[model samples]
Target: MSGSEALDQGPLRVLSFGCRLNTSESVAMRDLARRGGHAEALLVNTCAVTAEAERQARKAIRRAARDNPGTPILVTGCAAQLRPAEWAALPGVSRVIGNADKLTPEAWNAAAPPAPVSDVMAARQAAAHLVTEFAGRARAFLQVQQGCDHRCTFCVIPFGRGPSRSVPLGAVVEQARAAVAAGYREVVLTGVDIASFGPDLPGRPSLGQAVRRLLALVPELPRLRLSSLDPAAIDEELWRLLAEEPRLMPHLHLSLQHGDDLMLKRMKRRHSRAGALAAAARARTLRPGIALGADLIAGFPTETEAHFAAMLDFVTEAGLHFLHVFPYSERPGTPAARMPQLPVPLRRERAARLRAAGTAAAEHFYQTRLEQARQGQKETVLMEAPDRGHTEHFAPLRLVRGEARHGAVLQARVLGADARGLLAEVA
Candidate 1:
């Protein structure tokens, strides 16, 4: 699970966990729940990325039930999608909605809901739900794609998310335009496997095509950002956008789960270490100041110390500015779980080492930029909070004090660095 939060009103509260896609979908679900007059209920949007994630969701459900004894608790999202009955059987859960039903308003307000889930693989298209607002986000996320076509050995997401599908280009443009019209300075294109977008579309358009079209069609949008991307899937058009589209933010978070070639192959990943390096290099060459980030897994099944060492080196080689290090946790049914397993403690230890390296890399990047800021290099930041924002390169910044407005872009001469982030005052 990526994160969790609670939103409470008179009748409806939502507890959401997982990715930005989930966050966007939760906003849609929130609207549906509010409008359906189920606002008094508690909805838990769960994640099933790891066994720990499911455990956390279950724990959260129990706690929510204990805390709000009178409130009805509804469960949904990836964890629920995979095991609807399992969640339904939980003590506090009054009802369980599958991934397919989570966004459907009728399901939330049904007189009596049917069997909560259907054959997910049989569902072909992504539901095109345009969320008008993000309750507590600086930018609006537009989900242009959903589901995954590839089945990696270590992942259960494909089963939970269903087959790869794209929201039609027109719908994407309209959503982006609406977000810009609604006064959002930034729009992030999000999805289950965003880089794998458009294969199921009419023209077999690439992710690049959708992004190019979105920018062209919604010229008023000040900034466009992307979610996690597969290294092998970035096309020529995406490269062109990286080079030329100033509005396209200069940061790419890659879905490079590991660096060892054997581990990557065993994991059924398409890109190799060399390919990942090449992709990062190409992105950097195209967008000179672009920041690169990636998701890295430590201690995958049968991963040796040498293998992990290679991964640690790859982080520096790729010049990664951000890192999401996941400790390998065995999900019961995945192919990796059936393979030779690493001890849980060992996996966590490796993860900590990787995270420390990632932290050092991030700090180095911040310190370098802090020096540049001290040298009078002006940075423009979009204020997400009254005192917090991030740079275009996706570096976090904390305002020391200033006339700040949420969602407004500000030019600031970063004064110094701190544990919170870059300490800055308006230029």
Candidate 2:
């Protein structure tokens, strides 16, 4: 979960939750609110990825109401999209807007209808918002697409978001160019399912084609990165770019979900255990030592000890450098929720085990990088702060002997490793 404020003293305050998409949308909402003259509004953009996420959003809303008396709190995003009346009924909530209307200018108008949440499934086309500035970050997230078409049994995102819709190629390039103009060193192409990016477009371009074009058009853009991707849906053009494009960052975060084939089937995921390994192997082969990250779920319905063990082993086999582990949260109305459920304690335990494995793998990878740095290898670091930043591989780097301006990209050499991350010196 990520949170941000429009301005320290600005009249409108925005609290965003969930994925990068939500963060990008929050920034847009803040801009809309300011433009619409909603000076006393407090916007809470919520998420429904898991039950805990919704709980946290509710908690934040209550806290906001308690802390700022009489503020008109407008709730939006996935949680509100799914349950408008329920969220609108909450104390201090002035209105509940759906995902469909949240980004539109009309939704922010003071004279708009109350609780305006339309059926998300009815949405087909997704328009690109020219969001160049990301409130307080070095990297700008450019949403190239919207929603998800696949219905993974353990997921509720599709219902919260809408069908997979691509923001036209021209719009994507325009946004990337704008981000570069705004002095953003890095721009991450984010979406609900980016791998499924282009069939809806006129020419039916792939994600890789869009990327290649963006890099070409916006040659000054230093680095380009992608948000979480679906491993099973990677196209040939994307693979080619991975092997050739220097501007395209090497770090890839895959939405693997689960490692066991049986569990994947139960979860309605497209990739198998072997398919995931192949994806990782292909990535490393194309971009040697490229950092690999995965989103894995532990204790899915009917997952046995053997299944769990296989998943643990898969982590080591795939050489995953980062992991986003989640304990299975049974969402109501999902197919998995209707299946045989795993004990909540067991699910949490398995999640911990997966996280530990990921930690060990990441430490080992960092140590390897540290060794290379000792050998006098240099890395391009994008400083997110005066003394901290990340490498092309997305390794957290902390400068111990030098300082650089935020958003400055420069070469640096790693000096050592700490519990936090890599310690480095500007070269």
Best by lDDT: 2
Candidate 1 TM-score versus the reference: 0.97
lDDT of 1 at 119: 68
Residue 256 in model 1: lDDT: 98
Clashing pairs in 1: 11-39, 11-40, 12-39, 12-40
Q: How many backbone clashes does candidate 1 have?
A: 4
Clash number for candidate 2: 0
For model 2, the stretches where C-alpha displacement exceeds 4 angstroms are 1-9, 130-132
Report the error of model 1 at residue 421, Å: 2.6
lDDT, residue 123, candidate 2: 96
Per-residue accuracy of model 2 over 61-106 as CA lDDT, tens digit each: 8988899889999899998988889999888998888998888888
Full-model lDDT, candidate 2: 0.88
Off by over 4 Å in 1: 132-135
Q: Given candidate 2, what's the lDDT at residue 242? A: 97
Which lDDT tens digits does candidate 1 get at residues 1-427? 4567666655678778877788779878877777766757888888888787788888888887888787888788888888888898887777777776667778777456545577677877776666545566788888888889898899988889888888999998888888888888988888999898898889999989888988888899999989999999999999999999999999999999998899999899999999999999999999986889999999999999999999999999999978999998776688988999999999999999999988888888878888887777888898888888898988898887675888989898888875446778887
Error of 2 at 79 (Å): 0.9
